[model samples]
Target chain A: MSKHSIIISNISKSYGNIKAVDDISLNVKKGELFGLIGSDGAGKTTLLRILTTLLLSDSGNAQIENFDVKNNYKNIRQIVGYMPGRFSLYEDLSVEENLNFFASIFNTTVAQNYDLIKDVYSYIEPFKKRRAGQLSGGMKQKLALSCALIHKPKVLFLDEPTTGVDAVSRKEFWGMLKNLQKKDITIMVSTPYMDEAGLCDRISLMQNGKFMETDTPENIINKFQKQIYSIKSKNKQKLIKDLRKYKQTYSANIFGQAIHYIDKRNNIKIDELKNHLKSENHIDIEIKAVKPNIEDCFIELMKKEQSAVTNQLKN
Target chain B: MIPIIFIMPVVQLVILVYAANLEMKEINIIVINNDYGSLSRQLTDKFSSSPFFNVSFGNSHKEANSLMKKDKADIIMTIPHNFEKKLIKEKSADIQLLFNAVNGTKAAVAAGYCKNIIFNFNKDIIVNSPKLILEPINYKRINIINQFWYNPQLDYKIYMSTGILVILITIVSLFLSSMNLVREKEIGTIEQINVTPIKKFHFIAGKLIPFLIIALFELAFGLIIAKLLFNLPMSGSLLLLFVVAAIYLIAMLGLGLFISTVTETQQQAMFIAFFFYLVFIMMSGIFTPAESMPEWAQKINYINPVAWFMRVIRMILLKGSGFAQIKNEIFILTGYSITVLSLAVWRYRKTG
Candidate 1:
């Protein structure tokens, strides 16, 4: 087997005038849990589809386990498992029948892969006789995962697996993924939920069919050069407007109950900031230096990329 | 689905059979009996008493002809003056028969009924007259011996129900197979299938096999209902009928799959199937004779699967025709099956 689970080099796909996946390249190491984190319409699903052999890239070289995606698609298909964005199992069939049918299609039996799907299937075992269409969203999700893993595929591609799922179920699904990772299955998952990015061993933040950054979550956060400060006031809405008007304020956005602001300079004078807020008639105010999270790092990267594009347009 | 496979065909066959009759009844006849003799009156009684015609008397041929022109009379029979005297003296009589040939089949059948009545009247006259009977050699009469084979009584239900059964089977299989495949595409389950290691032809075969079994079973079910209800003839081997149905379904299901492959939604598939059903059923000689249609229409039936199946079922059910006689139809259907099925498989894209 190849050392890397998937190698996608310079892939691009377009639909009419819109480019869905544009000049993207990445390599996923064997047994690694890689995540593609992007908002809706960020081309995350498109890239995952191409990697799973369900679609072909217009211009790229993609291989799974060293099998070419175009010429050796059949070979690639045999080695990969895919869970699409939609809950696509046969609804008329009971959960057990759906799993069995998928297993039989790959020329394998459920008994052969019992241990592979044991953990994931356990959650849905009680309702195995219920029709998939009648299952709740979380149960359907677990059933889909069980069916996808039944064949013991080398690589599992999940496109937004936790989307439309409740928070507790989402956490349980990640726990299941963590258990599967112990089995040394290379898993690639995509989601718009930024908090789920920390669960993956590594993640790529994508925007407009291109990757803005790809690294471990800690590395991405540490790469943020700006010092972030959380400011609060009695009137939260007015505080955001007043902070944006500050001369040294570079970026100010509301993050939950506190407004996060970064200055043009690396350091901020607490006394000066207090005086400025006092002059603006902000009462019961509190300000503190806080660490940046994934969302904060994401906003910073987006701002940097936007300014670069603006400069290019101006030139 | 159960209703479509089991109950729908039986209901359509039962209801449509009554509406499918082609036998003509209640033909209006206007008679001008100028002779005013017993012989003319006797012939007039025959027309009125028979169930096939309704008789009306006119004073003269002018009124009779006018009545016919006005569409009141379907036939006009005129007895010439001195008709009884001429028959007694010369041993022959003259009469004029005119018919409205608007519907050619109905007119022809009506004429046959009239000829039978007239021939029987002549026999009665010859048998009753003592002079003619004593000198039997004076008049030479020719009699026609007619025999209707296969269907001695010519029951319309037998022929129509068989044709209807074939059409029902064809439509159900075609519609179900196509809709089944397209439903997957609509619900996005086809994406799951596409990502698997399933072969393209295997997928197509999987779609066809279930409907094929259901269609074949329904065919047998419909045949049983036909036999029980209408006493439909079963002179041919049951195995032969099943064999032909098996081959015919390959062509139908293939065509349905071909339609599904080209269409994106079930609605589109249904519309396209309906278009083909209209063309194929109309031109398949189901309700009308194929020979009576235009030449171009007959040529179009060569490619129509329903036309082939309709012809085969009638031949098998009514005539008890063996497989050797329908070899040409089977061959053509096999060719259609190959061409359409290959196109269906070739056009279906696993990766798009």
Candidate 2:
């Protein structure tokens, strides 16, 4: 077997004029938990679908466990388990029936792979006789994960599995993924939540069908290259407007309770920003430099990419 | 679903069989006695005595004409003045029979009844009075005897109920099978199934077999109803009927799967299935004979599975036909099943 569980080379797919996966290439090593972090319509689902052999690429080739996605799809299908963005299980079937059905389709019994899904299945096991449609959102996610893992697949693809799920369940779901990784199953999960990026071993920040960066979450945050200051005042709405009007402001965005402001000049004084806001009829001003997170890196990279496109258009 | 498969067929069979009758009955007649003579009275008595006609007396042609205008009378018979004297003196007389022709079939049947009654009255007069004959001439008369085959009584229920049974089976199998795969697609479960290692042939067969069994059961139930309720004949072997029905169902189920593959939603599948069903049933010779249809329509019916089954079922049940008599239809259905099922399997795709 190849060292890589999944390999792609310049895979590109387009719908009419819009490119869904634009000249993308990546490699997921054996037993690695890789995350594709991007907002909705960022082509994460499209790329995952192509890798799962459910869609054909307009140009390029991909492989799963050294089997070509086009010519050897049958072999790829045997080793990979895919959970689509929507809850796609039979709603009328009971929880136990859904798990057994997927197991049988793959020519395996649920008892054979019970160890792999024990942690996740235990959450919903008490309601195994209940119909799938009657389960809550979080319970449905657990059942879906259990069914996907029921066949002991070598690789699993989960597309936005945490979307629309409660926060506590989302955390527990990632914990379950960590347990599956320990069993040597390569996992590729996509999510729109930026905080989830820290949960994966290596994360790829994607936007507009392109990957901005692919590295550890800490490394991406450390490479921000510009200092971001979290500024607050009594009037947040007015403070944001004044900050944008400031000549030195490179970008000013409202992040939760404060504004994450970046100056054009790297070497800047905090008093200069404070004075500008102070002059805008502000009171009780607080300004402090804060460490950037994955969301900060993502916004910075997206801004750079947009300016680059505008420059090309000028040329 | 169980009720739809079992109870619906029985309800439809009973309702449609009794509703679609064509036999004529109780025709009303109004008699205008202008002569007030014994012979005219005797003619009126003859019309009243016939089982097919309900006779009433009217004084004048105007009165009977008004009754016909009001739709109260089906036929108005105007007897001429001096009808007995004219017949005795000149051996001829004129009587006008006016019929309400709004319902053309009813009008024609009523006219035929009036002619038979008048003919019988003339024969009675000729037999009773030999002096009225100017000369006795010898002539040879050839009597034609009528015998209706297959349906000796020409029972309309037997013909209609069998055809309706075929329609019932078609609806159960075709609509259900066509909606099955599309329902999966609409609910997004098909994507989950497509990722499995299941082959296309197995998937298609799995969808087809259950509906096929249900449709076959419906056919048997309908046949039993035909035997018990309508007293429909079962001249041919029941086993042969089922074998042909199985082949025919395979063809119908294949067509349904094909429709499912081409459509993305259950509603679309239903519309397409209904369109083909309407065309097939209209040309299936159920209500009208396929032989009498336009030449182009008959040619189109070659591909209509319902038409083939309608003809074969009637032939077997009514004519008591054997395998040799229906071998041609069986072969055609087999070929049709292979072609359509292959098309369905070929059209189904595991990847997009």
Candidate 3:
């Protein structure tokens, strides 16, 4: 019924002197499973909180389903379901009691919305008698989502929902979100997992409290302009330093078994890199061109921002 | 197997009942006697003979009352001028006795003891005074029957136990509700709820209602103990007491709710609660009589919901007072209950 389920415009939030969320704007299309991909302190949460109407923006505004986050917050609340980054249900209450209590608050019976949370509910329904405090982390995550979904909101804003969850639970939660999107419920989920970016219809690559770029996961990865290659040697640290000194090298950062280096090396080949590595006191040198993934794009964004900051400081 | 959680309340009850006594056996009283006549001497001798009475005043009852205000004397006894001539002439005489009634029960006991001595001394003189000189005199004897409405024997333990138990239940339950939510903020579960379509009022009411029911169970437990173990009479309507308790509990729970919303840590909320708890319990008339407190202290009682509740519980449970009898107290407590609850609801976190 709406073109954009959520619209954020020039939103800014400052915690003391630090701008947690700088002036940023984004639109979530109808039924789009959007992802806020950022590391810690990238202001992913501040953005989610602003869109969810939990924290007010210092300037600018956001809307969920034609409801202004500031002016029509009550209506926005009814339309949107927010699963905060934390497990916030009543831990002292039994699982069933917590569900019942939340259902009561919305003036709806649990029976009425059983279908909405049925998927998540089934995993935890057997443990309904268990005190929420005693539940394992995955179970708590599921229960928190079930409670949030009890009202069947139109827009779902999850602030890093899968941050601490196990791999299996994280996979299952995203699977559930995929199904929920079929119902045309716009889902906005935030996560630090670079691998999770592929699961979203669109992903925003962010670093240092700003969005580096926003596009389909494939397009963003496609536009990684530089060729990336991994070169590992006995002295990998020394290899990384030698690679950075190359004038044609665009970026170089150590990644697990090797250094993920991107370069504008026009005529240079892998053999040339290996020969140069050996000449620079490196041993057991191996270089292989590797596909650039989301992490590579994230590092590139961070480097671009860092160089810009350094350049401005010099000026 | 023994239940460990039940032990908490039971142990608290024991510690509270023993420490809640307001009675002071070592009361300091100052006497300023200017009249050295036979009457004054007899009056002094009579007071000095009683264990409850003591003479410590330097000047007069006025000075003693001032000293009492400044925590000097607990009580003061004054002797008027020419007290022997008035007694010999067979005329009724009076001596002023000033009491520091801030600590009601103690003050009431000391004042009554002093009055009894004066009355007895008067009767002795009226009977022994010259019969020939007086034209056939007959003296009247007065009888006083003291009755306690809810707690008839004036037992401090039962009175304090019932009132304090109610307070403990409401406070514990309310604190649990508040802390439950605050813990989420600490642990990060609240973010899930914040993004949900759940209404703000629903969240607050949902959190509050469970604790309210728990507090009700405790209230019933307290009333049962008051009726059976303590043998406190339930003369008025049980339904009335039940309704009144419910109303007063709303105020108590509201206080806890407000505390939870204003504070971040469970410890901070508890500290704020305990601070108010100290003031309310002391001024609630459980250990002291509201009637005997100073004008300013009495003014505070008007706003204190517990003070009003003690009167209702005693009237309904002890005196069996009807609506017409306790209508004023019921209205006041109900108002306090509603105001506190509304304030709690208003302050509850709606956006965050």
Candidate 4:
């Protein structure tokens, strides 16, 4: 068996003139929890569909657990379980019936793989008699996870599984994933929420059909390469506008109630920034150096990629 | 859904059988009397006494023509002046008959009825007139007695019911099967199924078998109604009918699967299916004879599955034909089923 559960090399897919998945490649080791973090239209779903053998890439190739996605798609289909972004279960069928149906299609019974999905399945077992369409959004997510895990697949592909789920349900869903990884099943999940990036062992920050960075969340943040300051004032909207107008501002964006600002130079003087904001009729100005998170690192990488493209165009 | 499947066929069968009548009756005729002679009055009374004609009197030929122009009359018969004198002196008299030819079939039938009435009146005159009896050297008369085969009464409902039953089966199986796969596409469940390890043949069979059984059940239900309400005959073996129906349904269901594969939505599938249904039903000879169509249309009916079954079912049920009688149609249907099903399977794709 190969050490890597998934090996994608220079896979490219295009829809007419628009490239949905540009030439992209990555490797996910067995038993590792990998995340593809990006906003909508970043080609995350397209890449996952290629790896699951549901779609063909226009160029390059991909493999799931050493089975070629092109020639050995049958073998790949037998080993991988996919949950699409939409609720695709038989809505008229009950929860237990839906799970049983998926399990039977995979040539296994629910009792055969009961232990694999016990943690997730147990959460919705009490409401198993209710129709799938009648279940709450969070309950539906749990049932979907149970169905995906019912066959004890070697690799599970979840495409935005928690997108419309509630916050508490999203957290619980992630917790369920952590448990599944302990059983040696390689998990590849995609989400638009940056806060969920920390849960994965490794993640690829994607934009415009290409990956900007692929590394551990902590390492990506460590490579921010500049000091980021969080500044708060009485007028947050005015503070953001004033910070963008400053000559030394590298980038100014609103993060919650404060503005995360970066400077053009290596070191920035906090009193100088406070005095600049005060001059603009700001009050209760507070500026402090704060450690960068995944969102901060993502913004910085995206900005760098944008500048690189413009420079290439000029050349 | 189950109730609708069972109820719709019965409703369509009853309503269509009762409403679609091909037999023509009650032709309206206008008679213009130019002579007040006894012979002319006798001819006018002969037309009014028959069950087929609704008779009305007119003063002049112009009045009858105007009535026909207003669509108030179907045929106009004008008796000429000196009608009795010409018949007595010259041994012949002219009676002019004009017909409204807007509906060609109705006009032709009405003209035939008029000819029969006139022929009978001539026979009465020859037998009753002492002068004609003495003068005639001989009269050789031949009459034809019609014995309608299979349907002695020539009830239009019996013929229409069988054709409607074939159509009912076609609609249920073809429309349902065509919409089945496209529905999954609409609901986004096809993507989930495509990722599974299920084989294409298995998937296609799973979709076909259930509808095939339901269609067969519908056929049985429609047959019961036909027998009870229309007194339709079932002279052929029920088993043979079902076997042939199974083969015919495979062809129809295959066509539907082909439509489903080509279309992306239920609405699109419905439109395409309806187009085929219209062409198939019209060309199937259900409402009209396939043999009487233009030569090119007759050639097109060779590829029409419904046309094949329509001819076969009538032969078996009405004519009590055996396997040897309908073997040619069965062979064609078997080949059609294989070709259409293979095409559908070939067109189905698991991955883009």
Candidate 5:
């Protein structure tokens, strides 16, 4: 039977009085590609830290590959690889030197684990002589991945691995992650880019140290409980405010090229909404029912949480 | 078998034990003897026989003074005229003693030696020529008393080693702390490390081991240099010195780790480490005695790990003091090492 690569139960961590990860719980199956999707500071890094055995929770506990995170961290560290949110590498060491150093730290040599990092390392091989501090964003990211995977860890944790990289580089990185997944390396990646969520086997949408939902990306999109419509007008600024005043409007937020609004008047037709907006001093009105994706799911989840808090306060 | 971890430390202890004690082996002295008589020759013999000083005869007082200012000489003695005639006429005489004040303690000792010779000379002259003092011309004179404490002469090498060791360790600790974290950052391997099956302590220890080796070597080199140049005595047990140094490194590395946790940029980490290094070095009592500090400043020494380490190293090296003599400093260092390390790990967990 395959071992559960990572398991966390009600793990909690705080800095002073602020709860960075509040009673969060989840599991990453032996070979699943798990993702924690959220905006920045959504407790993604905190949760990853605990699971990786680099952090001990204030309460609760976790185990990686059947080893207790607190007691068996050494064993866990040997088997897992982590790429933190920020680029942390020896600025003075050359690219090849860094790889050798980390590989040696794990009691392995680069030649032994050469196959694991061969793909990534090949891309940065031309720049191996360059000091790590001098590498470009994309090249540095590749070299960092090469070092992290040099030990051939059973599981990999990448925290916002694509942040600040160019679009082409982002696409290339995701492609590399896909190939690594084929190696049966259990991967947990955190990213602010919601579009990447669909590429994962499962995702947990997080906000303010809480997980709004945890499920497959397709399921999250399918289970979005609101009918979302995109509306655009000549005066977008005023159009958003006017749409909020409507008694039937449940939620309104700006998304891409339109003001996405969910309405309580589910029976109303699209043409009627357009004509109503035109009558209300909104020009060049266009309205359409758009298919909700992961982004739509996130907005709906946040609105629900906020309304719940407001109602509790009133009570 | 002695553990490899401790081999370097043992070597360091032996080197530093001899390195950190100074007993002023050679004092530079010049003779300005205007008394060209048998008495002048006798006085020069006394100085030449004493291994404590190297005498340069027939030099002018002003020339000798200039050598002292240039750091070439440490003492100058001027004998006034009427040297042999003073004894014949039974008149009082005085010899002028001058010393370099760069180290007030060493200067004071040289002056005390001059006083003792004069005192013994007066006694000898009176005993041999009893009738010469019948008029009771026990002519008024002066006496000066002085004492030197544990390293009483303010040995320069001893003074310098203690201070230099603190600075060296600070640099070592800072380097180690940043190295452990920044390695992951640079390799793009932090993400992989964060996913590792190994525990955090294992990861932290694995990173620290190599730097610890390098630092222990640095400590050894400093000690060896001190011993070869200054034949200072080795007073403390090797076991005790290593134990104290181990504890002190913990505190230093903890501080370095704490700095790494708060800084995103390695450049920023270096600046923060430098600031703390400067603060600890300035307060460690390597250059000045803690007894001379104000009460508030003295109280602060309780918290400064560098000061405690300096105290422990000097006490062990100079006084050859055992753990019993330095128990308070040992306890303080032990507490600091534990507290700082735990706090650093906690902060790292919070920020990681």
Candidate 6:
């Protein structure tokens, strides 16, 4: 068996003239939980679809468990389980029926792999007789996970499983995934939420069908070269406009009630930035340099990407 | 889906049995009585009282002929002048019955009704006057014998029930099979299934087997009810009928699968299936005889599986046709099954 469970090279997929997945490539190691973190339409779903053998990439090759995506698709299908972004299990069927159906299609029974899905199954077992379409969002996710894991697959692909789920369920869902990783299943998940990126072993931050950066969540945060400041004022709306007028300010974006901005001149003192806002009729302003998170890194990288495109167009 | 499977057959059987009546009644007759004798008046009263004929007196024979030509009158009875005198002296009278044969089936039925009325009138004359029996010249000596075989009663309900059973089986199997597949696509479940190691043949069989069983079950259930309700005769072997139905369903199911392959949504599949269903039903010779249709339409029946099944079902149920008699229909249906199933399998793609 190969050490790497998934390998995608030079994959490009286009829908009409819009490049949904443009010249992207990546790999997932065996037993590694990799995250493809991006907002909607960043080609996260498209890339996952290609690796799962549901779609053929426009260019280049993708392999799952050393099997070619195009030729060895049948082999690939045997070892991989995919939970699509949509709630796609048979709605007319009961919870247990849906589980049994997926299990039987893989030529196994739910009893055979009860232990593999017991964690998620416990939440849904009481509603075993209830129709799948009638379940709550959190319960549906649990059911989907249980069905996907029923076959004890070598790899699992989950696309935006936590998008519409509640915060508690989302956290609990990630906890379940971490538990599954101990069994040596290479899990590749995609999400539009930047907060979820920190839960993965490693993540590739994507934008507009291209990988902006790929690294451990902590490492990517460490590589944020620009210093981000958590600035608060009595009036955040006016402060944003005033802060953007500062010559040293590189970017000023709203984050919750406070504003996070990067400085062009690294050596600028806090007092100097404070006085600038104070001069703009801003009172009781607090500015402190803070550690950047993935969302800040994403915004900074997107800016850099856009500027690069503009430069190329200028040339 | 299960409720529909149970309900559709009964509802369709009731509607189809009642609506498919081809029996013509109340044929309008124009009587041109030139003789104002009591005998002519009595004959005219007999024609008017009969349920089959609606009688009206015409001003002249020419007017009655024109009325028949214009389709206003189905029949014209022109009683010649001095008809009573001739019958009394010459022992024979000439009365002409002209029929509009444009609609040949209706015309034939109307003519039969008129003949029965005239025959009854002849019996009355013979009974009233015993002297006429000695000559035996009052009536024409043309002896005509009528024998109706198979469905002797000409019960349209019996024919319609069997025909409708075939249609129900075809439609239910086709719609359910195709709609099942398209629903999977619509709900994105197909993507989940396609990514599995399941072979294409296994996938298609999985889709086909359930609906095939349900459709066949419906056919048996419907046939049993029809037999009980209408006393529908099964002249040929039940095993042979089922064997042919199984083959016929495969063709319809294949058409369904083919439609699913080309359509991405259930609505699209429905519309396309409906289009083909309309063409098949109209040309299946269920309401009209295939022989009465044009030559080109008869040629179209060569490719129509429903038409083949319709004819075969009627033959087996009504005419008691055996396997040898219907071998050609079975062969054609088998050919249709192979072509459609092969096309469906080829068109179903594992990947986009």
For each candidate, what is chain B's TM-score?
Answer: 0.86, 0.86, 0.66, 0.94, 0.65, 0.83
DockQ of 6: 0.67
Model 3 residue A166 lDDT score: 91
True contacts kept of 2: 0.89
The full ranking of all candidates by TM-score, starting with the best, is 4, 2, 6, 1, 3, 5
Put the candidates in DockQ order, highest first: 4, 2, 1, 6, 3, 5
Q: Which stretches of candidate 1 lie over 4 Å from their true place?
A: A232-249, A269-286, B26-45, B54-142
Tens digits of per-residue lDDT, candidate 3, B1-352, equal 1233345445556677768765546667677776677667767777777776566646655666678789878877777776666656647566767788886767887777777888788766666656325533355445677875555566777666666665666566656765766666677666656655566677777777777777776666666655555565667888777777777777777777777778888788778877877787788877658788999999988888777887777677666898889889888888887888788778766575
Measured over the true interface residues after superposition, the C-alpha RMSD of each candidate is 0.7, 0.5, 2.7, 0.7, 5.0, 0.8
Which pairs clash in model 1?
none
* Leading candidate by TM-score: 4
> How much is the lDDT of residue B59 in candidate 4?
88
2 or 6: which has the higher lDDT? 2
RMSD of 4: 1.9
Best by DockQ: 4
Error of 6 at A133 (Å): 1.0
- lDDT for position B266 in model 1: 97
Model 1: per-residue Cα lDDT at residue A259: 95
DockQ of each: 0.70, 0.84, 0.44, 0.87, 0.24, 0.67
Candidate 3 segments exceeding 4 Å error: A92-131, A241-250, A269-272, B1-162, B169-181, B187-190, B194-202
Assess every candidate by TM-score: 0.88, 0.92, 0.77, 0.96, 0.62, 0.90
| Each candidate structure's count of clashing pairs | 0, 0, 19, 0, 37, 0
lDDT of 1 by residue, B194-257 (tens): 9999999899989999889988988988899999999999988889889889989998999999
Question: For model 6, what is the error of residue A236's alpha carbon versus the real structure, in angstroms, after optimal superposition?
Answer: 3.1
lDDT of 4 by residue, B1-352 (tens): 9899878878998998888878766778988878778788878889989998999988877888888899999998889889877887777799999999999988998898889998888877777876553455444656689999999999989899999999999998899999999999999888989999998999999999999999999999999999999999999888899999999999999999999999999999999999999999999999889999999999999999999999989998999999999999999999999999999999989997
lDDT of 5 by residue, A1-315 (tens): 436777888888899988889888888798889989999888898888887766678998887788888887777778778887777777788998988878876778999978878888888999889899899898888987887798888888898999999999899998899999999899999999999999899999999888999999989888976788899888888989989987778888888779998888757677767767877988788788888989889878887899999999999
Q: How many angstroms is residue B174 displaced in model 6 relative to the true structure, after the best TM-score fit?
A: 1.5
Per-residue alpha-carbon lDDT of candidate 4 for residues A1-315, written as tens digits (9 for 90 to 100): 789999999999999888989999999999999999999999999999998888989999988899999999999988898999998888999999999999989989999999999999999999999999999999988898888888788999999999999999999999999999999999999999999999999999999999999999999988878898999999998888888889999999999988999999887778887788888999998888999999998888889999999999999
User: By lDDT, who's the top model here?
Assistant: 4
TM-score of the A-chain for all models: 0.97, 0.98, 0.94, 0.99, 0.95, 0.98
